[model samples]
Target: MVQSASIQLENPQEWDLSDLYQSFDDPRLMQDLEALQQTAANFRDNYRGKVKDLSAEQVLDCLQQLEAISQQAGFLYAFPALIFAADTRNAEAKQMQDKVMEAVTGIENQLLFFDLELKSLDDQKFAELESASVLQPYQHYLYNIAKFRPYKLSEEVEQTRNQDSLTGRQAFINLRSLHLGEQEYDPVTTPDGKTCSTEAELSALLFHPDRDVRYEAYQSVRKVMQQHNSLYAYILNTVAQDHKLENQMRGYESTLQKQLLADEVSEPVFRAIMDGTKSRFDLWQRYYTLKGKALGQKIRTCDVYAPWGNDPVPPLSYQQGVDTLLAALSQFDVNYARRAEEFFLKNWVDAKVRPGKRGGAFCWYAHGKHSYLLLSYTEDYNSLFTLAHEMGHGLHFAWIGDRQSYFNSNPPMVLAEIASTFNELLLLDYLLKQAEDNPQLKQALITRQLEDQLNLLFRQSTVSRLELAIHDRVTQGSFDQSFVNEQWQSLYQDLCGEAVEVLPEHQVDWARIGHIYFKPFYCYQYTASNIVSLACYQKYREVGKDFIPGYMELLAAGGSLDQVKALRQYVDVDLENPATIAAALKYVEGLLDQLQATL
Candidate 1:
């Protein structure tokens, strides 16, 4: 008889597209598109001049109907964009995405007057409509719209701005994505003699045990980025300047002012986090000093991710990894375990490392039906943590999809990572306990956890500061390539101190972070999320099994509440307090002590 070892676990259930549509060619898609167009046209025809004249109930019903239609259109357009990004070479998928974007753009253009019209209503009428039960669920969003009433432009100007946005500054950013964002790397031979060059491959090299390999990978990456620096710098400068112009027009006090307002967070809270992290820069320096001694090098930025010692890569079978995650999750609650198992069993994840698939992992939930996970799994220890992290995001999406409408499906980025990072913290704690008897594994786990904190806290904080400096300079009409490079060096020096040498070639690092180009002032969320997760992790340790249900409920709340409200409700931490961030740094300090003991 054949050995049972010869059998392998089959891949999990692939995404069920029926809920989206039976297929791309399914008639429902076309019907939905046509219905969306008709709805927009009908809404404009019926409500353009009649909203103020209608009763509160009628106004609320009209807004709900419009939102429902818009939500359907959003799913129709976004699902294809995600599908295309995962497999860009698919001609049909690409065409479908393009068609949907065009149709949605047209629909949006037709409905551009809705917000302005609503804002034009008298205060008493607006209050009555807002208080209507039908619209009460969307009060937060509506109130946010009303908050902008003070700055509302004339209908003609607003329409012009909306139209120009598509072809003006926005088009430049879109062009950058199509042109400058495509980076190709030269292949480097690994120790095993296999050559690899993709971004994912080079990223993995950063974790390689061989110092020479890690250094070479870093050099290659810097070289590639340097080659594109001129173009990248132009894109960066233009995007920042564009933001400056828009913010000035919108009467924002500063570039970051609007972002703070949207997050329902104050600038001082942001300043406190930044100032608090900077004051503890020595923590990062200490980490790098320990890392350099372990790697036996006078550390450089290139050696930052080099492995500490000669240890063979531990191989993890896919099933074993899944089992590990499930077991670790079981500590939380049965629901958490069941949800994770569903991801493995229901085909919700794309785990193969295929050619041209996007690098990095993400959980995409286009509709309430399911969430899709993208990963190039390598079966290493970090890969296991990555799977757990992305699955955490998936579980959050699954829970929120069941509880919220599509319009309210996504929480702010501030609250978004609470679930994902909480999952990572749980997994790390589980692993640490399991390895208590295995000294080498335990040391490695602690080291890895510390590295993650460095990335999420120190590195992200540095990036946030750089973003603020660049935007400030742009607002002052003085931002350029030299300014950005100087800011990068200054921030790096401040964070890393004398522990590592910042190479001249690393100056263009800002250009490589896609977030700067796509999202302004967004890296702060990583810092915020990490610290929030750290506090939540501690709470879990204190409360044990009692904490899981409340955590799940937080995920299920989605965008219904702002970050501050959701976090306070579940984790009982206040973003306004310095103690929250301080507590997380203390945890990192404790981990460092543990690692030093092992050394």
Candidate 2:
């Protein structure tokens, strides 16, 4: 629970997992798990070696069965996974999560032959399968599987890898999570000598108006990371080595290519984001300089996230925040607002700040159902934005669930952040409109908007660059903590220039980025998605009401359509063109102009 005076909500919301399961002891949960295992076994026995020879109708039948198994397995996985996320220290939840994971992996291993056999089919046979009208509903899914034909290993080898991951690559990932959840941090003291502990409480101080409090809170985080630097370095290196060996085994040319293939994104599009953002480092440095000028002092790296002026954005209770979000969404589309409200009314969000809870917010969805949003809300401006961001994800998948099947509900990584970030933009637009008469409030809102773009566009690109460097360096030779620290410092130096002082503790920051340890190449999508959303928002501004229908259509398309084609079809955005990035940056420059005028 948030014991800090900073808490504004009298009673924060907690999610009801009963939607998935009444309790861990639910007999239905065990029955479903056993049935899922048996179904997967039957599937393997029936079709393991016959996928290539199956007729179109037979293939469609197998696909429907496969989809059912996936949906059931996903449901089972969600219950314990969400439970563990809400409370990592729950022994029963962690055990159940592990058990479910092991079962799911075994099941996946059994089904591996289906895809491997399909991939191994001769081109003529595959083409014949594709030409079947019966398979039209899964055309994109089949096509996606075909895209990885060149990289897949033999069935036996694939299953071996899958089974080994329980103790291999995945165990280290779990270690990082469990370790972070179990450890306690040093108490951060305020100017009045008040002490704050919990990660959420300490993190909230980053936005404190007092610079020393921000610095102390920042140091409190960094000191812990520094102490655990060696352990994190080992985990990172081991995961990198695992990926490297897998790439070699599977014949992937590079790590980046392996990740991009899943997103259906080409190397050129990724390079465009990397080069496009790095080229605009000047804009990043300029904003910090402007921030320093406004604050009457040169800012430190810790001050980068500090409140902009003497008057930070006023705190709102949980209800007030939700109401404001509902109003903003209602203005865009009544259906969207209604969908956003469901999460709150249904107790689908976990907003309480408690020990053993994970540090940031995330929206998790079960197919044919709703999304569960987890965040430790401290009732600050950032928490309000966090609520909006996660709600964006919730609303997005709700639309997806209504329009697509389980397998097709998850959008590609590059397109995943679109709805979430767009929600933040809507919230900002609403806040700005409401603050039109108050200059101080207007400045705070505009500054928040500008700084958000800077973080998503510039800071994320730097993180991606560091990821590339880490992988590239690992391929050359083994590295230690100093190597990773140097890579982080050098990258920030290039991005921040001399505008802000890069503190020594900041060098160990790489160890704290969960994405680097868990999901490789994930940070870049933040930059990529922000670029796409900004362009979409710009179009909305020009076309007004007409844009809502197309935007809704884009969300409803889900993963059934090729993301690139879906964007072009629903909205006129062409991500293939490098000029798209330039247009987005031009919009950022317009934001800078707004800030300058406001100042």
Candidate 3:
């Protein structure tokens, strides 16, 4: 629900979860849960502790069954999850979500022995199973499991971790979401006498032409975050320690080793991207200096997002935002537009922010052919980009799941952001075209485009660096709120260097960052995917239509192809080599040069 505005903002809306079930109380829900449990029991009864004894055909059959059971469970859980996200205050939905999670835990427990048994096979025996021609389709999925063989805990410990997480790390994440959803922000008066209050509204001021407005919004946001300082810091440390303890128990070499293994990305590739971005910190510094000089002030962290010129991009309604995103995606492929259209036309998108609703957005897909997208979509330039971003994810899920089986439907996390970020790049190009004749507007667009690159490439790298530091530090000793604040501010200074002044208020941003509390070591994916998308965008710039077919093929590829293998096939990117990152760095520098020249 947006407040008063000059334009007619689209009303916030909810999605119809009926496609999954008529209601939460639908008997089908219970039937599916019971059946999932029964199916898991049967699977365990058939395959438990028997991987070494089973023939190749038996292993394949067992995997197929496991896939089917998991899909059914996913379908069941998606509804309550959607309902809870759509309105976290709904008592019935919360109860249903809790019950479903409890049931799913039982299912995880029943199926716990399957993967452990699979990982237990000797190398020669495992090679024989993997070499079976009939098992080719499951090769990617099976091969991924083998990577975790060294880290595999006993079946009992694995199940314990699964069950314990509902109360441990996950509960902290849930609390943080609730804390963010219910928090209030006081209205700040803008230079133009406008009053802003909502999280979305205050956020827009951070990029306002008036420095006072941006400073006030910064102070207001930091004030709200500091109000919950102790709680957020505790949640962050708890989550970090949870990961650290789990890593030690599971025999993981590093805290991030599990995510690397899970994402199917190599260590060298992740480091290459991090090192590449850090090595090119001057580009970030240069952009900040140029933008700050244009505004006639030293750039502060609050001013880091400032546009090159004061001309504001007009407000784009939610419907207009969808149209704009689809039009940009249509330039890529008709199928991309078609899939994106489903989220809007099919009533599959929930684009609203309200008390008790989730604070951010995510596009969710189950075994079904469709998707549901959630966003706190305020009608602004940034909100429009958010729409494009989430819808990109919707298109990816719709395309990939349509072609791949349940076990093979999800791409590596590092590559997951590619389609989403690519859509944003498309939108940026489209926006630039609209501003060709207006100098101020064009400068604003270029500023936004370049700032977005910095945010994704450089800012995410800093967050990743901080996350790694936190995880490594938590292993040794205890930390308090001040300890975290100090580390966060230090990283901020390191990223901004002498170009952007690191504001004292912005250090509390570390406390408010939900991703660090929720998904350990996940922010790096944004950087990794942005680099890959930049490379693909470069190819599209050169070959035009010749790039679309292969690009579309990459989206259609799920876990059926490993990330490095898929990138090589689609874009010939050698992700392991420093050159891939070097290329993206060069692109960023070129964009900076273009912006400086054009503006």
Highest lDDT model number: 2
Clash count (model 2, backbone only): 0
Cα lDDT tens digits, model 3, 15-108, are 7778889897699999989878888888778777777899888888888888888888888889988888877777788788878988998898
Candidate 1 lDDT by residue in tens digits, 455-534: 88889878989988888788667566788888899889888889998988789877768778777878888888888888
Could you estimate the TM-score for every candidate? 0.92, 0.97, 0.94
Kindly list the per-residue Cα lDDT of model 2 for residues 1-599, writing each as its tens digit: 11122323356799998979998999999999999999999988888777877999999898888888998888899999999999999999999999999999999998988888999999999988888899887888889888999988988899999999999999999988888888788888887676888788888998888998898889888888898999899889989888888989999877888888987788999998999998999998998998999899898889998777796667777767777888898888887888887787778999998989988889998886788999988887789999999999899899898888876888987677999999999999998899989887778788888889999999888898998998888777788888999999989988889899998899998887889988888998998889999889989999999998999889987888899998999988888888889988888888898788767
C-alpha RMSD for every candidate: 3.4, 3.2, 3.5
The whole-model C-alpha lDDT of candidate 2 against the native structure comes to 0.87
Candidate 2 — worst ten consecutive residues by lDDT sum?
Answer: 1-10
Candidate 2 residue spans exceeding 4 A from truth: 1-10, 191-194
Give lDDT per model, in order.
0.77, 0.87, 0.81
Q: Candidate 1: deviation at residue 547, Å?
A: 1.8
